[model samples]
Target: MSYDLLLTGAEQGDVAVRDGLIAAVGPGLPRDARQVVDVSGRLVAPGLIDLHTHVGPGYWSIDPDPIAWFSGVTTWVDAGSAGAYTWGGLRRVATESAVRVPALLNISAVGLAGRTGENRDLANCDTALAIDTIQANRDLFHGIKVRIDAEVVGVNGVEPLRRGLAAAEACKVPVMVHIGAAPPAVDEVLDLLRPGDIVTHCASGIASPLGPAVRSAAERGVLLDLGHGSGGFAFDVLEAQLDAGLRPHTVSTDLHARSVFGPVFDLPTTMAKLLAVGVPLADVLTAVTKNPADALGLPGGTLTVGAPADLAIFEVRAEQFSVTDAHRQTRTSPIRLVNEATYVGGRLLSPRLPAPPAPWVPLTRAQHAALTRRERHIRDLLATPLVDVDGLAEQFPRTKPRSS
Candidate 1:
């Protein structure tokens, strides 16, 4: 049978797509398709799923499409960028985005309108309202998110988390809690999480969650996620976790306005950081792909027949490359997964330039210079002609009038 599109000669074998789903996958499969792309020697995997990100309308949020076109992150989970009151705005974002945008609803009604202090009031963490919102918007929301830190919760401590958990429990969904500096200690937050709950920024340098509490939580099936935001991750903390036999279940870039420009550039860069920390390439791939999908129960994490046709093609360049964490600590990765193309539902994503950083988002002088240089380079390349005269073909050739 003919298919809509066929990917041939990929390392994962030929993949057939029809009706926006994988029709078949194997070696020597029928190549009868409307379009065929030869991707030999390229690593073709399910589109990367970022378990923790901010793509909704908020102070922290950024457009996911501009980055997704090149980063191969098909599913951008907007973790707590919106709450019950602000969900309508987030819903619009999901509707307009080119990639899939499932979200974890924030517990506070204020959401992330400002940088922090969403939960400081406690009146915003209305459990009943959160539960109702989740029930009403199950299609877009998968779970709940709460920032349990000193600054965010202020004197309230884990009360906001408890409210979030109550909402999640009522809705029968998991909760993804952001861990950071303490007033309520890390133990207080980790101990309250249920089996399927997720702890984002598990390797945070500021939080230092490397105690018996973290270990016990992991042992009890609590999933740990590497949410590498601007100040979330530290190389030392990750190394210690690796030494302790506690590998991250999923790798996610807390990709938002502030972090997108620097340390957490994209998902692949975050994966490379994992590679530098002695994680196997296969495990790293799983962390970005299947593992994150399973964590949030989203689709498009495998090439299995009947799965969504979202895919990422990468050139696995084997070379020494230096990758850095949020703390400016650097390490060398043996390979770099450079994305060649990203596809969603069998359609290739077009190139999109990201908007300038928000005014409130701070940038170092070096970062500012780099952004300027990149813009200049793009402008220079686009201003030049794509091809010369020889590359063009004349459609209508002038002929002597009526050789008759």
Candidate 2:
């Protein structure tokens, strides 16, 4: 075959990636391939996209970036680590790395600091702070990230969401809200979200369960994301939602230190779990690739010749594997397969990869110079007086008086 690379396998049939693109895909290859590898038991598919992941400074236990290289995720969106107060450093870290990191600016200025004293005061959610942050580092930031779960928001309820919507509106982008176990009900949160904004952890396993209300939201064009994390996804809720025709528009692993084992081993493992739940293989691929690509406005999830050669090769096996939800309930099935390797722009990476660097190494001088410029602009906005925030308050929903 006259191909640069050739993969022959039962699942793959015959596939070739050449000149950093999928050059050929059929039953046979040309005789002049520069490299040919037999993959008889492995499956071939597009590299994964994780729309929700917790690898960030807040998840201080782990390195925020390189989770993609370790988990077979080619593209990942860091779900809110730095809001207005700290977005500069996070953006700087992302720009200095080779990993592709798109971020959802957290609604809370302090970001995800878990439980008591964690929820930054509502006043800190300055619409001006958010707008200026977005304007200053618009290239790195996308949308707003609000953790609406009860444990994360406490007595404040959906007030944080209101602020997030305001910030998203101010920045002219979508807001991705974390749902499931939120008070005032998921319905209330859904009501506040406009079409095109996102609801993640849609299959949340706890108190504020998902139901027909979610289906209604889906019908109204709200993006439902299955971001199965350590405490979000519930099998019962997910099954019920699916039964009600509220299929998740995107499948993601809200991968973190706590969830990246057995049940949520990696992004591919999460995909396999969704497949076992009656989602077709092609549909699963779409959830992780095309859907997220459209959501994030990125490219390279298809086999279109001339696109970047980012791909994942897997071995769909009959070996038994167990999948567990947030509550530790097991769902063992015998059809899941593991990723064999991943390729980014034609560079293949083994699945048994080690963990990425930690503590976020300092940026190079060139990178430091580039990041400093953006940081200064955001800091300047934060220094602006409260009088300059009237435009933001207008975006907040006006509280209506109760009828007598």
Candidate 3:
């Protein structure tokens, strides 16, 4: 078969495309038909699918393309930012977006107004309305989202989750529940979820002491997803779980306005954090790609013979990079995954995130200092680094040990 482009990576091959679907892929193929662009010496894989991101009409969400395209995520789901009362506004925004947006319908009618919790009032938990909203927009609606944080639904208890689970059952879709500090307890929330249901923020300290209930729910096929948001990821919590052999089914950045500036920068950075935490690189790749797509039953995770040519080009470099969790704990990794460009439906997109760095470019003083400061919270939360302020020029650099 003829080919359009060849992405030579660890899995080197010439990929062919016809009407958006990948027609064929192999080495030394007939370069017979169309335009051919060669990207040799890069890492190529399926476009990332983040199962949990908070993207709406920019209330809690950041403009998704700037964050997603830069991170090589072609598809993402806005966890719980719009509901029955605010769905129209978000729907309008999704229509104008550059990224492929799939949303998990929020249980609260008001969705996430400003940064306020959506499930404060018991009246906001409307199963009938949630079902109607999903039926209205079956193209965009994929599942149910309920943030069962203690602060989110103080007195409302787990009624929102109950309503969400009920709606999910009626709609025959999965429910993605956000587990935070317990008011009704984590086990009660776990009990309500069915197989294929997702429990996000599995690494947060808030969802503590997963003894039998979490394990039992996992045995029943309940999926655990990483939802790294502000105060949503803690190193100790993740280490404890990882040591106990609990891994996330999907890795997602709850990228809103709050997290885009620090800690939870983007999907690539989030995946890098998991790698730093000792998860295998292949495991990290699968969590962001196939696991999320399979969980949601999407059609474009793998580069199958007849699948849409959604792909991401990445550069994996070895450097002294550090990642900080929400609890102010830090970990460093020698291998960092950086996104270069992305393609959706066989068409390459102009990158919106900054272009990838050289294979081995050193970080500038300002850049290095910023990263060090972000992680130094583990040591002195109040104190600043004691570097020579006068010698901070890019040319006169000092190689200091990275802060943890």
Candidate 4:
């Protein structure tokens, strides 16, 4: 094909890009005119899209471009970094900075910041304000973000959720609710969520669980996204949910300054962890690319002709890696991998890195006790051998009995 530029290689390749869309693809092309890339021994795929991230660096105190472009994540959705009150500021600083950062306005006025129990105020979620903010910033704000955690919302129950949904309906958009242990069941949140709406942090601690809830959500056509942040991802919960045929609609890093140190190093690392956990490479890519794009109602990732030339190249290496979440639960799994580089519109954004170091920190007495309690509860569920699905046995294989 007569193309403007191309990347000639077997494992990875680029295409002719005009303006911002991909014009042609496949190895070999003109040596002059525009530019040429050589991707030799790496698998090339569409640019990673993180459906959930707190990109508000100023107020949310999370770095914006820390991992977005460098970690192969071309686009990200800021999950509740701002609300009606701070939406304008977030747009000016965070969203318009360097990468693509669509926002999910928090139902609470101050967003996930302010105080711990800010969402419990009830008055923070002025439906009118939420609707107005969403309408005013229609292009930037795509959905409502309501965190339905017991600790985050205290005794507010589903008031924040209700407000979020009401605002979403008014704005003609979906609501993304953060689900974990909470008052109004995850099922309740799923029941309220529509087909286009999103449920983030779907699989968290075992106390609240995620399998049954995810099954229900899938049946209801609600989208479940892996908001794998520091504290929001539980290995046991994800393994269980996936085994039960409850597949996530998206795989997001939920990347923040706090979660980016080691455990949740970057989006590529997070994706590799999921791959190690048994999610197929194609499925994982779909979750991060097409699925999230569809959920966010954006058009970017994909190698199909006429699409954007955004891409990521990765090399899966044979190495052992330890994955850790916010709760300090560590899962040491073999088959570690990392990103090689990233491209946006046929332009290389950032090169990838080598395998990351371990991220587990020494637990204190109180923290260790808490982690023990959490692990024991998860074990209780795992002990009763699942009879319904043999898939569970394969996904979360254990040679030794889980700790009691």
Off by over 4 Å in 3: 1-4, 8-12, 353-404
lDDT of 2 by residue, 304-339 (tens): 666667777777777777777777776755577567
Clashing pairs in 1: none
Report the C-alpha lDDT of model 4 over 1-404, residue by residue, as the tens digit: 44455655735344566666778666654554366667676677788888988766333345555455566777778888887777776787554545677788889887755425658788888999989888888788888888887776788888788888888898888899887775767677677777788888777663345536556667877887878876678777787887777767898877764565544667777777687678887888899899888887877868778987777766766787777765666665466556676766666664323222123333347655765675687778779877767554587776997888
lDDT value, residue 63 of candidate 1: 95
List clashing residue pairs in candidate 2. 1-30, 1-31, 1-32, 43-314
Backbone-clash count (model 1): 0
- Among all candidates shown, the one with the greatest TM-score: 1
TM-score to native of every candidate shown: 0.98, 0.78, 0.85, 0.80
Output the lDDT of residue 147, model 2: 78
- For model 1 the TM-score comes to 0.98
- Tens-place lDDT per residue, model 3, 276-344, is 888988889999999999898886888778987888888889886799887768898768888888877
Per-model CA lDDT versus the true structure: 0.94, 0.72, 0.80, 0.72
Query: How many backbone clashes does every candidate have?
Result: 0, 4, 0, 2
Model 2 regions more than 4 Å off: 1-34, 64-70, 96-98, 113-118, 350-404
Q: Pull out the clashing pairs in model 3.
A: none
Off by over 4 Å in 1: 402-404
